[model samples]
Structures are given as structure tokens and as C-alpha cells.
Target: MFIRFLKENRYVSLLLTFLRLYLGWQWLHAGWGKISDGTFDASGFLNGAVKNMSGEHPSVQPWWGYFLKEVALPYVDLFNVLVPWGEFFVGLGLILGVFTSFSILMGLTMNFAYMFSGTTSTNPQMVLIGIFILIAGVNAGKIGLDHWFIPFFRRMLFKNTEKEFPQNI
Candidate 1:
């Protein structure tokens, strides 16, 4: 019942728009700060995550730390570019309601990555909001560009008979 309401209700979509805007702004600010500073480095964070695996509490799991140490740290240079730009693009996609599902999923992936690295901060809250947005599905972006863009693409991609596709597509 709750999921149905979230997926179909117009009022819920309004609420989701506000949530999307807030979450999108948060991501945009973080990314823009890193990009503008131009001194962003993931090596420090990756090393810290690996170090966190040794403490008594062991905030980061051993497997995750190993991955960070071996896979991530070795490609720190690529992360230097990917992280900031990925965040920026995810934020833009969410705000514009372009590829809304993909944006939320990518943002969640980043949130989980940060949490796995032992940094909590506001990631939990962001992840909760992102979950709500994802649950809302197409309705979450109905008021934005997805309203027009989705239908256009559907029409273009499914060009066939005179049959009309459902608006939910």
C-alpha cells in the first residue's frame, strides 16, 4: 500500500522533488568544492580507510580495506578526476531529473563507498533520502525534465505501429 502510494501519488512526487533538490544540492556542493580547490586527492582517504582496518573497533571491514589498499590506492590518479566529476554529474542529473534512477543509484553507490571507508558524516541521512527517491520511481521526476524526455525517448526507441505506449514508461 505504501509503495503504491509512493509510486503513483502526485502529492508524494512534490515531496520527492523537494527531497531531490536538497540531496542534489548537497552532492553538488561537495563536488564543486573539490573541483574548485583542485587539490582533491583520494590517496589520503584510501590510506586512512586501510589504516582504519587495524584499530580495535575496526570501522572499515578487512575486505573493503584490502580492496582500497590494492585496487583503489593504485589508481588514485584516476579517482582524482573521477570522484569530483562523478559527484558533479550525479548531482546535475538528479537536479534536472534526467536519468533520475541512474543518478540515485550512483549517488547511493558513492554513499555506501564512503560509509564502507569508515566516514559516516551525513551519508546515512543522504542514503535514506535517496532510498525514498528511488522508491518514488518515475513519479519522483514527473515534475521535471523526465516528464517530457522519457516519453520522447520511448517514442523514438519503440517506433513501430500506431500503438501508443503507456505514459508510465
Candidate 2:
């Protein structure tokens, strides 16, 4: 019942619009800050996460730490580029409601990655809001660009369906 309300309610969609804007701004700010400074580095952060895996409680899991030390660290340059741009684009998408679901998923992915790296910060809060936005789905973007994009894309996708697929089949 609650899920249906979240997914279908018009009032809820308005509320979701607010949430999307907030999350979008948060992400955009963070990414823009990093991009503007031009000094954002993942090595120090990655090393810190790896170190956290050593303690008794282990804030970061061993597997995650290994991946960080091996995969992420070695490709820090790629991350250096990907992180800011990815965040920026995700934020832009959410803000514009261009691809709300994809934006939320990307945001959630980053949130979880941060949490796994032992940084609590606002990732949890963002994740919670993101999950709500995700659940709301198309309704979350109905007040934004998805209002037109969805229908447009739908027409484009199915416009030639009848001709493409044989009726006999």
C-alpha cells in the first residue's frame, strides 16, 4: 500500500521533486567544488580506506580494501576523471529530471562506495533520500523533464514495432 502510494501518488511526486532537487544540489556542489579546485585526489582517500581494513573492527572490508589497493589505486587517474564528471552528470540528470532513475542509481552507487570506504558523512542520508526517489521512479521526474522525455522516448522506441516484428510470429 505504501509502495503504491509512493509510486503512483501525485502529491508524493511533488514531495519527490523536492527530494530530487536537494540531492541534486548536494551532489552538484560536491562535484563542482572538486572540479573547480582541480586538486581532488583519490590516492590519499583510497590508502585511508585500505588502512581502515587492518583494525580489529575493520571499518572497510578486506575484499573492498584489496580492490581499492589494486584496482582503484592503480587506476586513480581514471577515477580522478570519472568521479567528478560522473557526480556532475548524475546531479545534472537528477536536477533536470532527465534520467531520474539512472541518476539515483548512480548516486546510490557512489553513496555505498563512500560508506564502504569508511566515510559516513552525508552518504547515508543521501542514500535514504535516493532510495525514496528511486522508489518513486517516473513520478519523481513527472514534474521535471521526464514529463515529455518519457513519452517521446516511448514513441521512438515503439514507433516501428508493428513493422519490425512479424504478426504471424
Candidate 3:
């Protein structure tokens, strides 16, 4: 039974692994460029260039500017420092297959927040990515470090018996 299930679902796992690696590389490359530049000061460029647009009005400011300003801006400097690093780490984790579930969850959460902000054309893309991550069950370790580390971590952190992998329908 287990062998049959694995055989049937093997393609799904492979697809997810490839998807994760591609998405991870895309994010990592973008974040790495930003990190290398070592400057988050887009205030003038953004306010000047993107503050006015026909379709969305403000394309430079991320979708969640209001939240970043009204809510998150109090610590805007801190956010500037953390956000790039967070993106890099998320990308790295996804590519390496380490903490794959958490990495996907974090990306999904961030993308959802952006989608809710009602500011960018990228919202649709973000939604699509989220759907892909969910459908792929990207957390189900396949050719990644999570296959080994997750079990050890689970055993160390939780006292409950390990759960069995669900059969593919």
C-alpha cells in the first residue's frame, strides 16, 4: 500500500521540489541584489516616480504602505533592516529544503499581506504563488535537508508519537 501510494504521488513531490527551487532562486536573486546595493532609500524615487500612476497610482510603495506607515512605520528603520534579510533567508530555506514548511508559510503570509494591501498589480501573482505552495504541499520533504532534520527536530521538541504521512488520493 505504501509503495503504491509513493509511486502515484512521486510526480507531485518532484514537481513541488522544482517549483520551490525556482521560486526560491527568483526571490534569492532579487534579495541578493538589494542586499548588495546596501541602500533602502527609495523615498525620492518612489514618491516621485511611482506616487502617480494611471492604473494603481502608487507602484513604488509596496502594496502595504499604509500598514507600513501607520502601523509598521514606527519601526520603519527596523523593518528596512529585517525585510531584505527575511526574504533572503526564506529563499535560502526553500532552495535548501530546510524548514520547507515554515519557509513556504512565511512566504505565503508575506504575499497575502501584500495582496490585501490593494496597491499593486503583483497581487494576482502573489495569490497564484500562494495557491501553488498550498497545492504542492511543499512541506512534504522531497530531496531536501528537511527529510532528516525535521524528524529529529520533531522528536526532540514534541513528546507525542510521530504521525504517518497521508496517502495520496
Candidate 4:
């Protein structure tokens, strides 16, 4: 019953759009700060996460800990570049509604990753918001750019003309 309302309602979309904007600004600011700052490195955070692995109530999953120790530590430079820019692009996508679903999903993925590393922070709240945005789907972006972009892309790819695309009524 509730699912029907979420899937069918207009109000839900408005709520999701609001949520998207809120989240977008957050991501954008964080990313932009990292970019503008003289120095920002993932090494310290990764080391802290690794140290958390030995405690009785380990915050990070052991597998994640291993990945951090081996792969991420080996290439902290790559993560240094990826995380900030990734956040910025995700925020831009959300703000523009260029790829609303994809952007929110990626944001949710990052939220989970941050949580796995044991820094709770605001990630849980962001995760919830991302989930709502994901559920809202097209309507979440109905008021934004995707309304025009998706259709245009579809027309271009599918040749959605009466003559080129056959009617199936």
C-alpha cells in the first residue's frame, strides 16, 4: 500500500527533489573544499581505518580493511584524486538532475564505503536520503534537466519518429 503511494504520487517527487538539492550542496562543498585546500590526503584516514580493525568491536569489515591496507595504501595517490572529484561530479549530477538515479546510487555507495571505514558522521542520514531519491526515480528529476535530456537521448538513439519508429497500437 505504501509502496503504491511512493511510486504513484507527485508529492513524493517534490520531497525527493528537495532532498537531492540538500545532498548535492553537501557533497559539492565537501569536494570543493578538498580540491581547494592546499593538501588533502586519504592516507591518514585509511591508516585510521586499518588501526580500527584490531579492536574488539572493529568498525571496518576485515575484507575492507585488507583492501585498504593492500590496494588503497599502495595507491593512496589515486584515491586522493578520485574521492574529491568523484564527490564533486556526483553533486553536479544531482544538482543538474542529469542522471538523478545514477548520481544518488553512487552517493549511496560512497556513504556505505565511508561507514564501512568506521567514520559514522552524517553518512547514515545521507544513505537514507539517497535511498528515497533512488526510489523516486524519474519523478525525482521530473522538474530538472533529465525531463528534457533523457527524452532527447531516447529519441536520438531510438529514432523515435513516426516513420523511423513503427507504431505498435
Superior candidate under TM-score, 2 versus 3: 2
Question: How much lDDT does candidate 4 score?
Answer: 0.85
CA lDDT scores, all candidates in order? 0.91, 0.90, 0.61, 0.85
Clashing pairs in 1: none
In candidate 4, list every pair of residues with a backbone clash: none
**Where is model 2 more than 4 Å wrong at Cα?**
162-169
TM-score of each: 0.93, 0.94, 0.69, 0.89
What's the distance in Å from true for residue 54, model 4? 1.2
> What local lDDT score does residue 45 receive in model 4, on the 0 to 100 scale?
98
Q: Which tens-of-lDDT digit does each residue in 8-101 have in candidate 4?
A: 5788878778888999998988889999994989999999999988877889889999989999999999999999998998899898887888
**Each candidate's root-mean-square deviation in Å?**
1.7, 4.0, 5.5, 3.5
Model 1 segments more than 4 A misplaced: 161-169
User: What digit string (tens of lDDT, one per residue) describes model 2 on residues 29-83?
Assistant: 8899889999999889999999999977999999999999989999999999889
Alpha-carbon shift of residue 114 in model 2 (angstroms): 0.3
Tell me the lDDT of model 3 at 43. 44
User: What are the clashing pairs of model 3?
Assistant: none
Error of 3 at 63 (Å): 13
